[model samples]
Target: MDEKTCRFLPAWDPVLRFLHWWNAAAMTAMAATGIIFMVCGPDLPEGTEDALVSIHASVGFLFGAGVLARIIWLFIGTETARWTDMLPISAHHRKVFADTVRFYLRGFRGETPLYLAHNSFAGPVYLGFFVLAAVQVASGSSMLGLPEEIRSKSMAQELHATVFLLLLLYIIAHLVAVFIHEIAEKRGIVSAMIHGKKTFTDDERDSILEAHPLAQKGDFDERKD
Candidate 1:
């Protein structure tokens, strides 16, 4: 086993990356279109306004579809991407989990737990983001689920507004989490998400508590970079 392959390894598979980027793109398009529909509503007529709304509904449906696909993939995916990879699922690992989070609380100080999957606590952060995003998408689509024959403009507007606010807040929190981890953890966690590489010191190998990224790999010793 390569000594360099420690916890928190780059375990995001190609399919996971595909779903993430695709969902992001669809969501962006939906937000932009929804914004235009809202801002231009003042001058729009009953017919044109209705058409714009239908488009928004379509976008929401697509977003929901992507979310569903990702959720399913999460279950059937590789061991690294599976739901179990996010937490210390076994009862025996509880205290080790505590110590791992304590290490983060201490700036990943000293040798952290060698994680074969995700760090004991960091798992929750990722899971929280998924839950929040799913909720926002679902709530946003509820308005569309209402009958078009009795469509309520005000209600639709409110749903869009609420979803946007929650989405904005969640995204802000996500960025802040990434920044905090990178600065405090010294692991380049965010960059690893984007580029699939993390900088690790000798101490990092000892302290990491993830499974896939932290698990032993064969090529690390020969690769200088």
Candidate 2:
């Protein structure tokens, strides 16, 4: 039988918590722009059209900065924030990821792996979406930065339009994944990222960090992936 999820486990470090919440807030702003950008499509109230695009561009810039800061922190940040922690590490991990997928797809949770930080099962899913977010934002920024002549550039237009289309699809996929993960798995992961702590069963916690002496220490948690 599965251990009940903990209501009070220490989850993320302070820095990790800060960045996560900050990024989430930025993402919300980006999401708003995403909707407006899609529906409005260069259309705005007569007096505020330019103002709206400017706001969109400014928000894009802010989100881009957040993304860049995250990259730098990925290199110099705390545990639970490193690239490796976010990605799968072994065959067992691959299996866990696959099983998680199968569990979601087939509506069966039998034999799923337990994870402390990123569940081996969900690791790749998180990594994939993060990558998609990075690409979407990058292409979105390029689109927003259309210098007069570059505005008409075929490559710029293609990148801007194509990335937007793909980003829309990715957003839908991301939301669906979150809802499914939440419903079937009973993990409020999206809200956890907001709250900055998730409870793990006692054994699951130990088994995961036991292999890495360094990971257990807050001092060494900042080491590169």
Candidate 3:
């Protein structure tokens, strides 16, 4: 296993990538429409606000469906897609999280730990996103048919706006971190989401897959001769 040599292995599965990009598109649409309402104050000329609301609601429903499917997949999807792999609660994962923080603190100058799927630090952040998405979906759903007066003052409305802001912040931070990780590690972090593969050195790959059996490549055999 030469230090310069690397192996391309499975990271995200097909279903995971599809749901990821689908939700990303849906969120972008929701954010666009939401920003319009926030900027124009819901008093757009004629029926413009209504039209935006329709678009927002339709996209929100699709986002909600995608979120639901993702949650279900966390239970039944591939090993990398499962909840166990995405929670940063284990001792090993906590160490990975600490090392990741140090990697950032050092200005991306040193070697960072390798992960086949979501990095340990990112796993919990993703879980938080799902929680925020759930709240966003529930609050938005509750406002669907309510009277304008109640809708304006409802708890649902408040939660919806707050979750939107939180998600906006999350998106900004996520993008920055991803870009930095891609540049620093040269691991194809951005492209991996699209192609479901990541490059790892032979030693890194073997050690990671061996430590986390579930992270083993789906098509790779582990049986000893």
Candidate 4:
């Protein structure tokens, strides 16, 4: 569609976009190194395993810092990027969440709820991801800091591995959901993350303008600035 005719809304701020990508890259690196450490460390030449472990630890620290920055941004970010936006606290939000669930349960047959940012149903899942990441950091740090004898006896390693597996599953599910949204809804789900804007259909724009006038205005102002 032509720019003059199409309605584009700012969905993610630059900082949010940066965090999304930074975290994605860091997580992917950590996952790769972690898997190699777990699966190939035993067979690798001497010192290689230790190097991998060191690399994983360094990446894990960076990822932890990114997570902390994200948490801070949750409070300072734009309306759609705030923690409140991801939570279904209001009745309207809950209803939309239910509708979103129904949209998927019915095999994408019905109208999907349009969101300027994340869908209501995804808020809880995002929260769960944050919690899972925190757990991973904690478990990993605990294991890394423990003495060799204590490390062998402690459950931190097991907890760390378990959380990493869960994180892998979460990443896979997240990718699948992104593809589903891209193919089924044609929402530019992936591009939105990269470019920080979401182009809405005429109907979607109208719905958002009517329901969230202030939010629309703020988005427009931010884009103009």
Error of 4 at 124 (Å): 0.7
Please, what are the lDDT tens digits per residue for candidate 2 over residues 6-76? 44333455666666567667767766765675688556675576666677677777767777677776678
Better by lDDT, candidate 3 or 1: 3
- Please give the lDDT score at residue 134 for candidate 3: 89
TM agreement with the true structure for every prediction: 0.64, 0.72, 0.91, 0.90
Looking at model 2, residue 10 earns an lDDT score of 39
Candidate models: Cα lDDT each: 0.62, 0.60, 0.84, 0.79
Q: lDDT tens string, model 3, 101-193? A: 899788887878667787888998899999899899999999998988999999999999999999999999999989888988776878889
Candidate 3, residue 6: CA error in Å? 2.9
Q: What's the residue-level lDDT of 5 in candidate 1?
A: 50
Candidate 3 is scored at a TM of 0.91
Give the local distance difference test score of model 4.
0.79
Q: Which residue pairs collide in model 4, if any?
A: none
C-alpha lDDT of residue 133 in model 3: 98
> Candidate 1 residues 67-163, lDDT tens each?
8877787699865666676766654246457866676678756645544335556676667656766776766666665765545565654665775
- What are the RMSD figures for all models against the true structure? 5.4, 5.4, 3.3, 2.7
